[model samples]
Target chain A: MTADVRDVWTYLADTPLLGLTATLIAWDAASWIWRRARMTPLLNPVLLAIVMIVIFLSATGIDYRRYFAGAQFIHFLLGPATVALAIPLYRQIHALRRSALAVTIALAFGSVTAAASAVGIAWALGASRSTILSLAPKSATTPIAMGIAKEIGGLPSLTAVLVLLTGIVGATMGPWLLAKLKVADPRAQGLALGVASHGIGTARALQSGEVAGAFSGLAMGLNGLATAILVPLLVRWLLN
Target chain B: MLSYITVLLGCQLAGETIVRLLGIPIPGPVVGMVVLFLLLAIRGGVPEGLDKVGRALLLNLSLLFVPAGVGVMVYLQRIAKEWLPISAALVIGTLITIAVTGLAMSALVKGRRQ
Candidate 1:
């Protein structure tokens, strides 16, 4: 019976369908719970889904690579989804223009602070150089963050995890912090979430309203651009 | 839906091509986003189908990151070893960024009004 079960597990694991199916099931289950819980920030669907999938993989003895083989289908949508961000961003064109200077200045300050503070705090706390580099791009979206990490002599995989954690942290803690700060403007709220948290934060911002979501998407894209250009230069100066 | 997907994929393809040719540091999808944004600006509005597809994609954006998030397992040992700096940087750094950006954007935009 044990041998038969092992054979079945191995056979099923090889198909891409299982990985894809597992990912969708996990996300749906997590989303359902998140809604049931009244959409608390602590119960972020992405975080919950990731935790569930991680546990499932570990218990089943499946490796990341094999799981990714199936999950890659969903992952592939990230590209198109990113492009889709342009629609919302474009819709907010008038608002974007009205606050162009504010957006530019705030984005500059926010982007610089994100990298500098992370790198500074990590280094001060005795993290190694590579780890510091990985932390520098944590605010960018995952793919760009991972790329920046690779270029700056950090562990790309470590950076990927760190990036995800940053998104989760931002999405979870961001609302409370904004509320505490009395940031009531949707544009400001969205920009903050996008700049600090990237896509996941934008996902949270969208739940608030379209105006917030559009700005969040805009901020996410702009920050990705800023961080990609800024971090490599910052790393050179800081590390050297 | 299919056409909208095609446009998105095409834009991404063009973005990848541009990045490859120019050897720029930006991600392909990001460039694609820019391209699509430009296209929409020229077109003067989002098509109904495009909006539907884009919203659908964005609606499930969080789900897309699950695969990459699970990659965290590969670095559990390293994370355990370096938990201090990692946790501090992510949590504190993220919160600080959010606070600064939110405050600055709000104040600046409000200041512009006056």
Candidate 2:
């Protein structure tokens, strides 16, 4: 009995596949729950997946590095998947073209407000400068947010967390809030999802309809560019 | 099916090539998307299988984020030490984002009417 148990432990420890298995299992489980909950934003798949992965890792005595080795395949897909968002965006080109000015303005305003308010509010709350810097770019996509965070002296890892949380909160409350405010225009819905939630929210928007998906994609791209430019400049000005 | 796969792969390749050649800082996937869009636009419509593949890809989109989220473990200590700041930033940033975006979009739409 002892030998059998020891062999299982050794296998789990040595094999990188364990982590991938764990991640998929957790993701599927979370999906089931979220779907059962009828896709409530509060019970978002990303949030639930993270929770499940954490609990599974801890309980199984597996370290994250080992798990990540097997899971990087999925990670590698993120870049390509993000690029694929353009298909839906392209399909809605007519709608996007019509709202070009609106989207451009929204991205500019949304990107600036997202960074400034985060820094200002954090500073007011007595957080350290580094914390404020990291928080400044939370609403942008991960890569841009990380770059901004690093440039402004904030922790990239912490900024990553903030990014995920931002996505979740955006995906969760966005549609509900939009409906409540009687914002029926798909363009508006798409723009809100993209600017606030980034990629994940865009994914959610895609499910809503083609027009919403395209606008969200536009928001994702423009917001990313705006933050990439504005965040560094803002931080430079603030620090100086 | 084969044609769809070919186009998808071609788009991915073209995307990477453009990014590398142009030295663009944007994500490769985003670039790939741009190329795919241009191709579709020029052709005047998405090819049949493209939609199916795109749908499959988007549907399982959340799965792709799993690995990155797990990467968060490396920053466990940093997260704990800066929990307050992180949380404050996320919550407040979200509110500001929603408000600014919603208002700006609403105003833009409204302005167009006038």
Q: Pick the candidate with the highest TM-score.
A: 1
Best prediction by DockQ:
1
lDDT values for all models: 0.87, 0.75
What would the TM-score be for candidate 1 when compared with the true structure? 0.89
- DockQ for each candidate? 0.67, 0.43
Instruction: Give a tens-digit lDDT track for model 1, residues B1-114.
Output: 899999999999998899889987666887888899989888888999999999998877778878877887887887888889989999999999999999999999899899
Candidate 1 — which residues are off by over 4 angstroms? A1-3, A150-157, A175-187, A199-214
**Which parts of model 2 have CA positions greater than 4 angstroms off?**
A119-137, A141-160, A171-186, A199-218, A225-240, B1-25
Give the lDDT of residue A110 in candidate 1: 95
Q: What is the lDDT of residue A3 in candidate 2?
A: 100
lDDT of 2 by residue, A1-240 (tens): 999999998887768787778788889899999889977667877778888887778887778778888888777665555555666667655556877888888778888888888888777767777777777778777755665566567776567667878888788778888787777778888888899889878878988998788788888767865776687778778878
